[model samples]
Target: MTDTASLGLEDRTARVIAGQRVWDELTPLLASRSCTLLAAIAYVGSHGGELIKLERGSSVIVDASVSAVRAGSTDPSVLAEWIGAGVGVYSLEGLHAKMILAESAGGSRPAFLIIGSANLSGSSAARLTESVILTDSRDCLDEARSELLAWKIRAGKPLTLEEVRALGEHYGADRSPGRKRSEQDDTHDAATPSEELPGSTPEASSASRQRPTQLLLVRLGEEFDPPSEVIYHRDRLSSELGCDDADSDSVLFVFRDQSEPEWRLPLSQGAYVIGVDASASGRVTKQTEVAPPGPVVYLYDDDDGGRYCYLHLTESSRDVTWADVTAAFESLGEKPEFDRNYFRKSAVDALLSLWPEY
Candidate 1:
């Protein structure tokens, strides 16, 4: 027998399912048939364990943020089960949308789509007050599938087995009292009376070793004589360059050099811009933009050298780091020596000239 529809009593095409009823309705649907499941949840917990019971074809995509897998929120055991079941597990950075699409063979119910404020967690599905739209509309399911496929395409890379294992280890370690205390001490650098003596702490001795460094947004010039570099202090630009604030976690480095032969500049020096997130945190987070299937862009020397390629920042540009850019190029099987030299005056001019084009 078909399950009794619970919430969203008002809408004809969609129903609002709330609280524990959300799981009540979902669990039966998942178990009744062999289906394909696609989920994008911002946060997950042991309650997500329900997914493990799904048939072999099911897939799940989760946000890779640390907070998503925080000790109390996500159950590592559940994740491990999903991985061991040969389920397709992926991580999409900056993913906050919570959705589930289930497609089944010919039956009374062939497709189902759930989208709502609740994440895949016990509190979210059963305890906390939450709302989700339950729909069987073909249009809604089709659109969701298309959007999800697009997100998967832009993810560039999936969370590997090693990454998942590391999450489990970290979750386990963070729960230990000793590990928590060590972490607290490392961040605070202060000791209690019962702890180490006043002047004997390791942090006290290492205070002199901290070095001052600044984040810079650089632009390489047309001549490529001096690689462009911007230097600033405390997230503020000290230079006369009229470029926007460089304090953001990610900064764009525009390369406007004359195109060179693929052989001369194995990395293919051309007019393209790349963004680097200098902030130490969230370096692996992918951008929302639909990035091209391959590297950011490829450059080939135009015979005249006058043909310039201008890159305007788009919603789809990936949030990467200097390290990521270097690594991506390296993966191309070409090791091009990157110019690390910082030139102040030339860097300013290059930005100024390119600012108008952007």
Candidate 2:
């Protein structure tokens, strides 16, 4: 007689795993299971394709909200495949929980349940920094199953094959060539310089030769003095700002001062500092009183005729203050007081005490 204890069923309860550990454990478990049900507030179709290919699952429920579409999280192609494969498909308006329930073949293996911050997408499962709690506890599994059932009964709307097909066609058309740019795409384009400028010749119109006449330093609500160091490059600026065009007039350029250790801006936060041309004219339309939680500084370089080295805060925090910005500059080895006299000097020594040597 085989000892069930040796099968490691008891050891599977209540553990947190992240990254590739999610894919490594989830794939084999799905393959061995007879019935798998997935409920996620968000779902991507490619992930659905992969899941259906692994095992014939009973059902999948996802949220079909405009926000998900704007974020490019849901794919209709995968949803169509789900319906074609005889898997039941459902959508709920406000579904936000992510859970998976799987029952083993013929009661031969322990049932499994997963709950976590991960979505049912390949990027979330394999690439993103995601964590989930997995367990085989009968009590937990039963409770999860019951709640999911209640949600389905009260909110789930069964998607018919025709509806899935129609949605797939709509998305396909939207993705087809010659489609109009989306508002999000346009916002991204505003920050990028993809095409040649309107009236200048290629030689004189180069982005490297354009110097912003004014630099604007702004936080949530108040504006500050521009930082002395600025570095501009299309790729770096685009990536840092989470936009496409690095040379848009409508958007502000933000970054951290180079004096601090290299840190990428967190996406969830709303705080930022903007860099504008001294020649540009605009009022501070956006407002936020809270400062970013940590120290942030700005840098700029105008030697190449391009605005570079703009720094801004990305995280949202109510505790950040002007003192934090001054302190970050002080940490770079010198604490020069800023005053009206300091602004009068244009020489390198006057602009930045810790400027990098080229």
Candidate 3:
């Protein structure tokens, strides 16, 4: 993201969270300089500029451009916006980078600061692309300033006082100790629509569809090695499961045959929905789940059949029950929502028809 390291400047004096993940190494470095700014985030959709506390920071710049997307090309711009939320996490542009942070400092070369290759989504990667990271630079700082300004004006995405106030309003009004974001508050409406894309209600899209069959396998990539605690806690059904971290791939993987891969389910097996829900807290929970909801699915529905549907658990760690889950499914059945329709984009019918029943 331009010069990614610039976000960590000013001893936390001024911090900006522009859709990217702020890092540790850049922490001490940016704090050293009085330069202030939040980090930038990347994904498959749009770059929404900045998301900061607005307590004591300014001079925020970001490279959230959508021009990166085009036929047969690597577009970083199209992948700059999905970092703040979890809607399209594994899509090519969505999974491009794990929150790229451009330093608050100016003049870092952006061409030298990216992290991955192959258009982010793990797919038909004819090439092995390589991206870099720039902790500090003046050139990058300039580009970021330009980028954010453009998105704010053209795309209408800007980190402003009004938006911050809105976030505060939503989070503050519910500070009633026991109050939670997920707690039923009819007065507080859920922004996500009841239903959005194809086959959204588990009724099967009226037209049989074909979707990019990308399987999230369990193998770890170059990015990270999860901590012991993190692993122990999530090991519930992750051991023998593939696609556990499919989203982890900088690039999304695709297959013509659903059964070709040893671990993935076939096209006619189960329905997949990308829904937005909140817990007791105010967080947009997006996922690709099996059985819609309400059913507490097991790790391996069929051992010999090699069929299994997984509900992606990005943040929630609590054990999910069938009753509540079914209700969720019921809720999902009510409606669907998202900037992009994953099912429609990639024909999901083939996969659903093959889902094995318990």
Candidate 4:
């Protein structure tokens, strides 16, 4: 007799997945055989596609509007990769729902319906407090799939691989250098804490949540040592900054001349947007090794400019100068005595408005 295993179709239950468990459950569903995936998520980060295993019969709908791309929310290049892998990638403007349906098309496995507040990004799993209602109910899965399909149909024409790639290229070429803010605004000063900090309330509103790319402002002293390689202390990252689960696409902006009582411009002409690969609070050494190791953060540049590049600085501070760099910091309430600190997305947008030639 052929060995038999139950697909667990009779179990029609749902459970809430919060914290890191959200990704723990999702990986298996994405890798399940004969399970067709249908996702309608709003934001697709630069590495979002890489997280998916790319099922043959998968179909994904995302917000691929020009505004979303320019805002660095949806990456068209990621969608292009999915399309290249034979995944049906569709673009729906202003799509905000995050739902994934994995149903066995020609097998005995039970269907899965995942509805949650998380986006299709690594940050959602790592940084955000996301909860998904996972159910093995085939009926619920079918209904959710139908609704997603309707949205897909309403999205109009599907994007071709070339078209998506071109869009990504266009976005890269057409991105603005930076925006300017009035020097009078100092609401984002690192010295003055924002009203809605992390864990300030019993529950966090949608507005209180941190952005995908949180900015780290490093004040480089005249005598401060600059490491040839990018590194961050684990304690400084976790205990001090509460960025224990910082996204890999996070940024680091350096500034100079903090020692001066009065300075013309503070923002360094050279800034490295460090993409944190790995962060260890304590010494992490090989099991077989006896030598002590120091805390470190593995850094790399991802090549989407300073914004997404992982390890290296996409722009050299030696190349460009921002005429209003000091003004930009002042607008964000950056104090003269400020040292290395973290800035939110709103403040980052205000300070780092200019890009390549800033």
Q: Would you estimate the TM-scores of all the predictions? A: 0.46, 0.46, 0.26, 0.46
Q: State which candidate, 3 or 4, has the greater lDDT.
A: 4
Q: Which ranges in model 2 have alpha carbons more than 4 Å from their true place? A: 1-9, 51-57, 170-358
- Per-residue CA lDDT of model 4 for 205-320, tens digit only, reads 21112121224433222232434332342223232323444542222222122223222221211112312111132222222111110111122222332211112122223322
lDDT of each: 0.44, 0.43, 0.28, 0.48
Residue 267, model 4: Cα distance from true site in angstroms: 33
The predictions' CA RMSDs to the true structure, in order, are: 16.1, 17.4, 18.3, 19.0
Which structure is stronger by TM-score: 2 or 4? 4
Candidate 4, backbone clash total: 18
Candidate 3: TM-score? 0.26
Task: Write the residue-wise lDDT of candidate 2 on 105-140 in tens digits.
Answer: 444555678787666565555555677787778898
Local lDDT at 183 for model 1: 32
* Deviation of model 2 at 16, angstroms: 2.1
| Residue lDDT tens for model 3, 1-358 | 4333344432322343222232323234334332243333332211122212111332322222211121112223222232232222122121122223334344552212222221222121111222334433446555655554443343233444333333232222211235332222211111111121122333212111223222211211123244444344235434322224565311112111123333232221122232223332323323323222111112232333332333332222233333343343353453222222222322333322323220
TM-score rank, highest first?
Answer: 4, 1, 2, 3
In order of lDDT, best first, we have 4, 1, 2, 3
Model 2: residue 96 alpha-carbon error in angstroms: 2.4
Worst ten-residue run, lDDT, model 3? 185-194
Whole-model lDDT, candidate 3? 0.28
